[model samples]
Target: MSLDDRQLLRYSRHILLDEVGIEGQERLCASHALILGAGGLGSPAALYLASAGVGRITLIDDDTVDLTNLQRQIAHTEARVGQRKVESARAAMLQINPEIRIDTLAQRADATRLRELVATADVALDCSDNFATRHALNRACVAHGVPLVSGAALRFAGQVSVFDTRPDAQGERGPCYACLFPEEAPAEEVNCATMGVLAPLVGLVGSLQAVEALKILSQAGNTLRGRLLLIDALDAEFQTVTLQRNPACPVCGHLTAA
Candidate 1:
């Protein structure tokens, strides 16, 4: 695909980068991303991807905008309090880049729907607040061989990682999300409603998710594959942990290989 005059100007900065030249920008323009949740993390991630010229973005969320969302959900305005979160987010994304096509699914990300959505997406981002949905998304992405970029933030802490079951250039398969956190493992259910996340904390992590998603789509830079990046807003420090796939992982067992 060739970049038209308008597209070249729209992505001028990206095209000028040594890491993301014209070819890379074209890849981004032809990519499709599915974002789960239109809340804190999804808000910024969706906006950035739209602005970056991702051809299609599908956002899934059942929630509505509330006054409390103003702190971290940069995509929604105070006036949109009663509107569906996806509606508010879509408006903001279109305002940023009218050239991009966006689809909004105002529903929860259940296992069945998640599987269908992941099957058609090039990459999926898990910005959902609950562990159940996150687990569902991970399983779906792994099954479909779609790259998954997962991020979470609560209180003052956040984490980001990528799971791509697809083999790398050297024929090495990266660890899937379930490989790091087994399905049977107990995970805390953290939410902004109860835990109270810092306003900018979500943006900090979500924007990073956007960057990782773009890199994965364009195949330009080294992503956080099989590694977890932890962010401590209170301490303002960042840490990385290497992740290994469990040989006995049920999700990646011979019966369910991606």
Candidate 2:
């Protein structure tokens, strides 16, 4: 979809970039993003994607806003405390850019639901807090050959990465999320609820998720396909670690076999 005069002005700063001129912005405007979870990470990620004019965004989350969520979940307000997270997030996103389409799913998705959602998305963002959901989303992305942007935050530490093993990509294909964190391995389910987190930590990770997602949607810049970005907000330290695909990954190993 071509950007109208109003849209061009709304996204003028993005259009000014040589790498993201009218063509790139158009690509973003025509892309669809799937965001899993509508809490802290999904909040900033969803809002940025909305403001950037990602044509459609499907947000899936089965939780409702609680008074405890106001600390970091910026998409919800005090008045919307009892509202479903996806619905609250949808309202916040529409307030940013009403021209785009926002789809809300207020349910905990199983494997079948994840497959259906990933099939239609141009890119998928893993903002869910649990390992179960993350693994499910990663598997779906691998099956559909869709790029996956994953992020997480706990305490003052955060990490983000892109896992895309699509056959047509140049150079060696990168690891899927499951390649680095094997699904068979026991994962300690940690979350902000049990282990408290810094407010801005999630924001930083979520924003990076948006940056990576936009890059994939626009074909601009190198994604963190084979690298993991770790942030230590308390000490203001940043680290990038290379990730290797596990040939025996239970979720994505079949891709190599095929």
Candidate 3:
């Protein structure tokens, strides 16, 4: 696909990079991504993905914009309160880049829907705030052989990781989300509602998730395939923990036959 004059100017910066030249930018423009939430993480991620000219983006969120979401959910404004999250986010995305296709699913991301979405998407972003949702996304991605970028931010802490089902040149398998935290390792749910999150904290992590998503889609930079990036906003510290695929993971393991 040849870049038009407008696309050339719009993606000039990306085309200027050696890693992401015209070809890579085209690859990115031909890719599709599904974001599983329209909250803080999804807000910035969808914004960047749209601005970057990703071919298509599907946003799944059952929630409506709330007054409290203005703190970090930049996509939703005070006037948009009470509107469906997907509708609010789609409007913001179109304002950024109307060239791309934006699909809005204003419903909860259940297992069946997740599987269908994952199958069609080139990459999946787990921007949901709950563990159950995260687990469901991971399982769907693994089943469909799609890469997943999982990110979370609450209070002063944030984390990001990429789970690629495809192995690297070394022939070693990439770790899935369950590799970082085993299924049986207790479950806890936290969000900006109960524990406040800094405004820029979510933007930082969410934007980074967008970065990882693009890299994975274009096969350009080194993704966080086996490394979990941890960020401490309060003290401004960053850490990386190595992860591995768990052979005993109930969701990803033994299900290759199913």
Candidate 4:
């Protein structure tokens, strides 16, 4: 894909980077990203992806924009409080980059829908708030061999990780989400609604998720494929832990064995 004069100027900052020059910018323009949820994490993730000129974005969320969401859900506004989250996010994303395509699905992320979307996506972002949705997306991404960038934030804590299930040239697969957090584990459904999250925590995690997604799509730099990043906003500390694929993982264990 060729960038015209206007596009070149629009993305001049990206093109100026040696790592993300014209070729990388074009790669970004041809990539497709699947994002789950349209809340805090998805807001910044989708915004950066769209602003970076990602060619296509498909966002899924069943909830509507509530007044309470305005605190951290940057994609929604006072005027869109009653609108569906996906619709509101799409509006915000398009407002940033009208040239890119944004698809909105105002529905929950189910296995069937996730499988279909993951198959078409170059990379998937698991920004959903609930464990059910996260595990569902992880399953779909592993099944389709797509890269999954997951992010979560609540209270003053946040976490981000990338699961690149696609095989390398040597047929080596990276650790999946299930390897880190097994699906069979008991549900610990804590969210911002109950815990009262810091407004910037989600933004920080979501923006990092976007950076990893762009790196995967544009082949710019090393991604956090097998590392988990943890953030403590209150203490202003960051930590990274190495991850390994579990041979007994229900999702990607077979790949490791093979």
Candidate 5:
């Protein structure tokens, strides 16, 4: 799949990078990305991925835009308040890159539906706002052997990481999301509404998620597969820590390395 003249011009900046030259750009232009949310984090993630020329994107969300969401969810406009979130996000993404395909599903995806969706996605982004959905996505990604880029933001704090259990050249794989935060041991669940998130924090984290997803799809740079990136908006600091896969991880432990 070669880039046409227009695509070359559109992705000239990415092609200039040695990491993402012509070959890498083509990979990105052929990849399929599944985004599981259309809220604060999903807004920027969808925007960037569409701008970056990911060929196909499937956005799943059951929520509707509200006046209060304008503070952080950039994909929704005030005029779209009563519209479904997936429709709003699709409109926002198409505005940037109409060449790409954006599939919108305005329904809450269950576990079975997640497995079906994950089966076809090259990579999945966890922008969902709850523990249950996050855990379910992790399980589905693990079962399907798809890479999952997870991001979360609340208040002045945020975190982003890649959970890819696929084996590397050395047959070693990174930890799944369950390895870091197990479902059985649930953390104190929080969201922007209850915790009052910093508006820009989610944008930063979601953009980071887009970066990781692009890397994985393009096979360009080393992804944050085994690293957890922690961001502190109050102090304006960023940190990355190595993550070790838990052998007893409930979601990914049973399967042998691929």
Candidate 6:
């Protein structure tokens, strides 16, 4: 995809970077990203991906925008309250870059739909606020051999990680989301609606998710593959921990065995 004069000017900052020169910028302009959920996390992720010139972005969410979502879901507006999340987000993304394509799915991301979407996406982002949706997206990415950028935020804490199922040159596959948080684990469900999250925490984590997705798509730099990033907003601390793929993980373990 050759960048026209207008595109080159619009993406001049990215093209100026040595890591993301003309070639990397072009890669971003040709990549497709699938985003699940258009809430807090998806807001920044979608906004940045569009502003960065990702060619196509598909956003899926069944819910409608509410007054509460305005605290962190930046893609929505007061006028869009009660509108479908995917529609709200689509309008915001296109506002950033009208040249890019935005697909809005005002429906739940079920197993069948996720599998099909992941198969066509260059990268899939798990921006959903719940474990069920996260697990489903992870499974589809694993099955389709697509990279997954997962993010979550609650209270003043947040975490983001990238799970690339594709094997590296050494034939080693990175851990999937299930490897980090098992589906059967006795984990309590926490969300911004109940726990009261700081407005910027979601922005911090979601922005990181977008950064990782862009890096993976453009092959610009090393991503958080097999690594977890933890952010403590109250203490203003950041931590990165190494992650190992669980050979017994029900989702991606079979690939290792095969």
Best model per lDDT: 5
lDDT of 6 by residue, 1-258 (tens): 899999999999999999999999999999999999899999999999999999999999999999999988999999999999999999988888999999889989799889999999999998997888889999999999999999998899999999997888788899999999999998888887788999989998999999999999989889999899999999989999999999999999989632
lDDT tens digits, residue span 1-258, model 1: 899999999899999998999999999999899999899999999999999999999999999999988988999999999999999999999999988889999988689989998898999999998878888998898788899999989899999999887877776677877788777888777687987989899999999999999999888889999899999999999999998867677776543333
lDDT (CA) per prediction: 0.90, 0.93, 0.90, 0.92, 0.94, 0.93
lDDT of 3 by residue, 188-258 (tens): 77678988999999999999999999998777979998899999999999999988777777766664332
How far does residue 124 in candidate 6 sit from its true spot (Å)? 0.6
Candidate 1 ranges with C-alpha deviation above 4 Å? 255-258
Pairs with backbone N, CA or C atoms under 3 Å apart (clashes), candidate 3: none
Q: Which stretches of candidate 6 lie over 4 Å from their true place?
A: none
- TM for every model, in the order presented, reads 0.97, 0.97, 0.96, 0.97, 0.98, 0.98
> Whole-model lDDT, candidate 4?
0.92
Clashing pairs in 1: none
Pairwise lDDT winner, candidates 2 and 3:
2
Lowest summed lDDT window (length 10), candidate 6: 249-258
lDDT of 4 at 200: 89
- Candidate 4 ranges beyond 4 A from true positions: 256-258
Candidate 2 per-residue C-alpha lDDT over 39-101 given as tens digits, one digit per residue, 9 for 90 to 100 = 999999999999999999999999999999999988899999999999999999999999999
Task: List model 5 lDDT by residue over 4-35, tens digit each.
Answer: 99999999999999999999999999999999
Q: Candidate 4, residues 1-258: lDDT per residue as tens digits?
A: 999999999999999999999999999999999999889999999999999999999999999999999998999999999999999999999999999999888888679988998999999999998888889999999998899999999899999999987776677788999899999988779988888999989999999999999999989888999899999999999999999988888888887533
Q: Judged by lDDT against the true structure, how good is candidate 5?
A: 0.94
